[model samples]
Target: MAELDKECLFCKIIQGTVPSYTVFENDDVKAFLDLSQVNPGHTLMVPKKHIINLLDYTPEDARRYLQYLPAIANAIKEFDTNITGMNITTNNGASANQVVMHSHVHFIPRFEGDGLKLATRNNAEKYTSADYEKIATKIKEQF
Candidate 1:
């Protein structure tokens, strides 16, 4: 493992150099209210260790980080009666809009009237069965 980045914002929060409204914390993970609340109960969960992104996680790191997500999400939901749904997401690289270098999972509480929407375009081209098989075969080969 690498040494903790003293300048990292998440690291600062974990070290108590910066203040945070921490909702949960354990030896391996921490959950806190997001500064930019997309909804009433938006929270951010992060590994206690400094990992750049999802691709950097070891299997143990991945397991420790993810195991608490369900309980944390449920706690957020129970905290507010207005929450109707939730969106949990983690962006990897800058191309995927990851602003922070440290990997973190976002727990966004959703309400029916909330303006937030995930936009997607159906720009995919049609493929033949053979093309699908070829694509699957290529991916399977890597595994």
Candidate 2:
């Protein structure tokens, strides 16, 4: 297990120092209802170990954490027949709107006409195939 941050809220929850409406828990991960529900069945999944964000996750840790999400999300879907889809999101940093330092995945159940939309304004700039290739090469170089 990674060393827990004594003051991290998620760490407190994992330690049972704070109360959470737990939906599921296993050796390496925990899922619970979010206090501020984006929808009625919104949930958050976090690794049992203290990982600050997605970039901090090792492949093994990420695999362990992600393996449980599908099952948990499916169960949430069963809670409402009206659930038409779901959104899985993880904000990596403050610039990405990550309020908590500890890593978490949001499982938001969606229904038709829920009035929720994930969108971004269009940019007039367009890239050519060479631009795409250059970007891909740059990313691949890091790997």
Candidate 3:
């Protein structure tokens, strides 16, 4: 087994200590209902391993963690036919509202006017094509 952070909330949930409405689970991942159901079928999928965030993921860790996304998302959608769309998202750091240090993906099922709002303020117009290329080049160099 991967080393578990016993202090981590996700680790306790995965280890069957903290009760959760588990929707799906396997050797590598577990999916369950989010306590605050922003919309019906709202769920969270997390790696069984005690990973902190995306920034800390090794390539192998990322591969094993992400391999379950498709099936988990499909399961959430299939669980509720009224779901008009879905948002699969994760926060990587404290500034991004990641209260839980352990990495998790939120599967938010959308219904028409379900009172959930997920919009980013438009800031694209501030950057020119040259600025975009410069930014892309800087980031792409890391690969």
Candidate 4:
């Protein structure tokens, strides 16, 4: 837990400052329906204690947060059995299109490219296994 902005939408939801279609709640985590759904039963999970992004979360918080994934996935599956698969995304920075400043995970069910599009860059730079290992090491070191 850390200092939080009472005005943040997510913070307000966590505090019961604002209304939400919440499906789950506990001492450390909260899950609720997304206002904008990519698919029916789309949901967002957040830590009860405010954290700005992945960079602001601790390992313990990350572990606890992840513990709720199976339940969320099951709910999505139950709601849309036709879903062939799913995607979990969390954006950290503005360039990544993270509209909300608060940290949260999006659970979106995918149905045969129903809502997915990505452009390929044939000549894009590539990283080797060793290069990726170095980057991973640096990221872990920052935490």
lDDT of each: 0.89, 0.91, 0.90, 0.82
After the best TM-score superposition of candidate 1, give how far the Cα of residue 23 lies from its true spot, in angstroms. Answer: 0.7
lDDT of candidate 1? 0.89
How should the candidates be ordered by TM-score, best one leading?
3, 2, 1, 4
RMSD of 2: 1.5
Return the clash pairs for model 1, or none.
none
Clashing pairs in 4: none
The TM-score that candidate 1 achieves is 0.91
Give stretches of model 3 more than 4 Å off.
none
Steric clash pairs (candidate 2):
none
* TM-score of every candidate relative to the true structure: 0.91, 0.93, 0.94, 0.79
Can you write out model 4's per-residue Cα lDDT over 1-143, one digit (the tens) per residue?
Answer: 35567878898888887899998889878899999987877799988777888878788978977788888888887787688887787889888788889999998878875867534466325877888899899999987
Model 4, position 127: C-alpha lDDT score:
78
lDDT-superior candidate, 2 or 4: 2
- The global Cα lDDT (0 to 1) of model 2 is 0.91
Worst 10 residues of 2 by lDDT: 119-128
TM-score of 4: 0.79
How far is 76's C-alpha from truth in model 2 (Å)? 0.7
Highest lDDT among the candidates is held by which one?
A: 2
**Model 4 misplaced regions, further than 4 Å:** 1-3, 118-143
Compute the lDDT for candidate 3.
0.90
In model 3, pairs of residues that clash are none
